[model samples]
Target: MSHPALAFSEAEYRVRISRAREQLVARGMDALLCFAQESHYYLTGYDGGGYVFFQCLVLTAEEKPLTLLCRRPDVSQARDTSLIDEIRIWLNAEDTDPANQLRGILSDLGFAGGRVGIELDTYGLTGKNHAAIQAAMDGFCTLVDGSDIVSSLRLVKSETELDYIRKAAALADDAYDSALDTARAGVVDAEVTAAIMTTTLRGGGDVSPAGPLVNSGSRAIYGRGVGGPRPLDAQDLLILEYAGTFRRYNCCIERSISIGGPTEAQRKLHGLVRETLEEMQTAFRPGDTLGTVDDIHRRRLDAAGHAEHRFAACGYSLGATYRPSWMDVPPMIYSGNPLVLEPGMVFFPHVMVGDPETRLAMGLGNTVLVTETGCEVMSRHSLDLPVR
Candidate 1:
C-alpha cells in the first residue's frame, strides 16, 4: 500500500516530543494523554480525525515508546502516518467501552496512581467521553487538565511552520482576489464561497478548517456565516472572511465589499475600520500585552461612535487548527488578556463594525506575523474595501 507524506521532518517531531515530555516532568506529570489532533500531529506526525472517536496518545515521561489507543479504522491511519508503533485497537462491538480499554493501556504502562495530564479543553474530549474516562480511570490514575501544554508549545512558529504559513497567506490573498472578481449583483453567495475555496485548492492549499464566512445583504452585519446562500442585491454589502490553508496551517483574511457602489456612510465607516486595523498593527509588538492591542481597537472604534457595532474581541492567534474553529484561543486578542506578544507568533485581527440601526457593515483585516521589529501583515492583498 502507498503511504502518505508527513508534514514535518521526523527530527522535528522528536524535538517536539522531547519538549512535551519535559513539560510533563516540570508539571509533575508522569504521563500525558494527548487527545487533540494537533497534539498527535505535533508530536508524532499523526493526522487522523479518529479523534472524533475515543482516541488517545499515551506519552510517558520516561524514555519509552508512545502508545495509541483507537478504533480499528485508525489502526492503519496511525501506522502509516505516525512514528507510534504500539497501537491498541478497540473493537466496534455494542458493548465496546474504549474508555475501559484506555484504562487497561494506562495500567500496562504502569501509570496506576500516577498523575497523568489529559487534554480536556479540546473537541476530541467530549463531555460524555470525559465522564466515561473519569469513571473508567477511577482510582487507577489521577488526570489533570493539560490542555495548554501542547498549545503553549505551538504558539511560536518554527522556521518550517512559518514557511507553510507564508504559503497559506499567498493562497488567502488569491482567495480574496477571487472573491472580489466573482462577487457581483445577482451572484449567489455560495458561488463566491466556491471561488474562494477553489483558489485555495488550486494554489495547493488544504481546505480551510473553519469558514470562508460569506455573509451577504443584512447578514453582512452579522459575524457568522449562515447555512443558506442568498443572492446579492444590486446594491448590497458582502463580508468575505476566509483563510488559505496549507498542510493544515492557516492564515485568515477578512474583507467587506460594497456590492455595487458604497454609500457615504459605508465608505467613511470602511476607512475608520481600516484605520483601526492599521493602529492595531502598530501596537502588535514584542513585550506588549494582547490587551493593549485590543484596548487600541476598542478605543479607536468607540471614539468613532461604533462601540456597539464592534466585536467584543478583535481577533486571535492562528495555526494548524481543526474543524469548528481556526482561531486558536488561549491568546485571543480581547480586552484584559495578558498574553505578551512574541516574535514568530501569528495573529488575525479584524476591525469589524456593523450598524444594525442603519443595516450597514464595514470590516477589514489580515493575518500578521510578529517580527523582531514589530509585526508583518502577511497578506499581499490591500486593506482597501473592494467595490464590486
Candidate 2:
C-alpha cells in the first residue's frame, strides 16, 4: 500500500509522539485517550474529522505504536494522512457503544486498572460520549482530565509550523487588500467575503476554519458573523475579520472599512482602535502575561469612553486549528489570564470598537509573532481605515 501523505515529515511526527508520551509519563498517566482532532493531527498526522462521531487516538506512555479507533469511513483517512498504522474500526449498530469497544482496546493494550488521561475539553468529546466512556471505563481505569497536555506543547511552534503561518499571513494580507478593493457602495457584503476567500484559495491557502466575517451597516457592531448578506448602504460601516489558512495553520486580520466618506465620529473611533492596536502590539513582549496585552486594550478603550463597545478579549493565540474557530484559544487575551508570552507563539491582537446606539464600529488588528525582545507584526496593510 502507498504511504499516506502527511503535512509534517515522519521524523517530525515521531518527535511529536515521543514528546507526547513524555508528557504522559510526566503527568503520571499510563495512557492518553486523545479526543481533540488537533491533538491527533499534531501527534500522529491523523487529519480526519471522524472525531465529530467517536474517533479517538490512544497513545501509551511507553514506546508503543499509536492506535486510532474510528468508524470504517475514517480507516482510509487515517491510513492516507497519518503515521498511525493500528486502525481499529467500531461498527454502527443501534446497541453499539464505541466507548465499551475503547475499553476492550485498553485491556488489549494492557491498560487494565491503569491511570488514564482523557481530553475532556474539546468539542470532539461531547457529554453523551463522555458518559459512555465513563461508564465503560468505570473500575477498568482511572480517568483524569489531561486536556492541556498536548495543547501546552503545541503552544510553541516549530520552525516548520511557523513557515506555514507566514504563508498564511501573506495570504491574509492579500485577502484584506482584495476585500478593500472589492468593497464599494451598493456592493453586497457576500461579495467582499468572496473576494477574501478567493484571494486565500488562489494563493494556495485553505478555507479558514471559521469565517471571513463580513458584516455591514448596523451589523458592523456585531461581535460575530451573522447569516445572510446585504447590500452596502451609500454610506456604511463594514467589519471584516478573517484568516488565511495553510495546512490548517491560520493567520488572522480584522479591520473595519468606511464604505463612504467617514463621519467625524467614525474617524475618531478608527483612530482610537488603531492606537489601541499599536499599543497592544508594543506590549506583545515575551515573559509578559497574555493578560497584560489585553490590559492595554481595555485601558485605552475604557479611558476613551468606549468601554461598553469593546470585547472582553482583545485577541487570542492563532495556529493550526479546525472548524468552528480560527482562534487557538484557552490562552485568550483577557484580563488576568496568566499564560506567559513565549517566543514563537503567534497571536492576533485586534482592537474592535462599536456603538450599537450610533450604529458605528471600527476595528484594526494584525497577526504577530512573539520574538526574543518583542514581536513582529505580520500584516503588511496600513493601520489607517480604508475609505471606499
Tell me, by TM-score, which candidate is best.
2
Q: Write the per-residue lDDT of candidate 2 for residues 259-317, one digit (tens) a residue.
A: 88899988888888888899899988899988988899999999999899999998988
Cα TM-score of candidate 2:
0.98
- Give the range of the ten consecutive residues with the poorest summed lDDT in model 1: 1-10
Looking at model 2, report the run of 10 residues with the lowest lDDT sum.
1-10
The Cα error of candidate 2 at residue 366, in Å, is 0.8
The sequence of per-residue lDDT tens digits that candidate 1 reaches over residues 1-388 is 2335678888888899999899999999999999998889888888788988889999889888799999888988788988885999988888989999889988888889999999998988899999999999999889899999999999999999999999999999888888888999999999999999999999999988887899988888888888997999999889888889999899999888888899998888888988889999998899988888889999998998888999999999999988878877778899999888899999999888888887889778888899998999998878886788
lDDT (C-alpha, whole model) for all candidates: 0.89, 0.90
Candidate 2, residue 283: how far the Cα is off, in Å: 1.1
What's the lDDT for residue 130 in model 1?
95
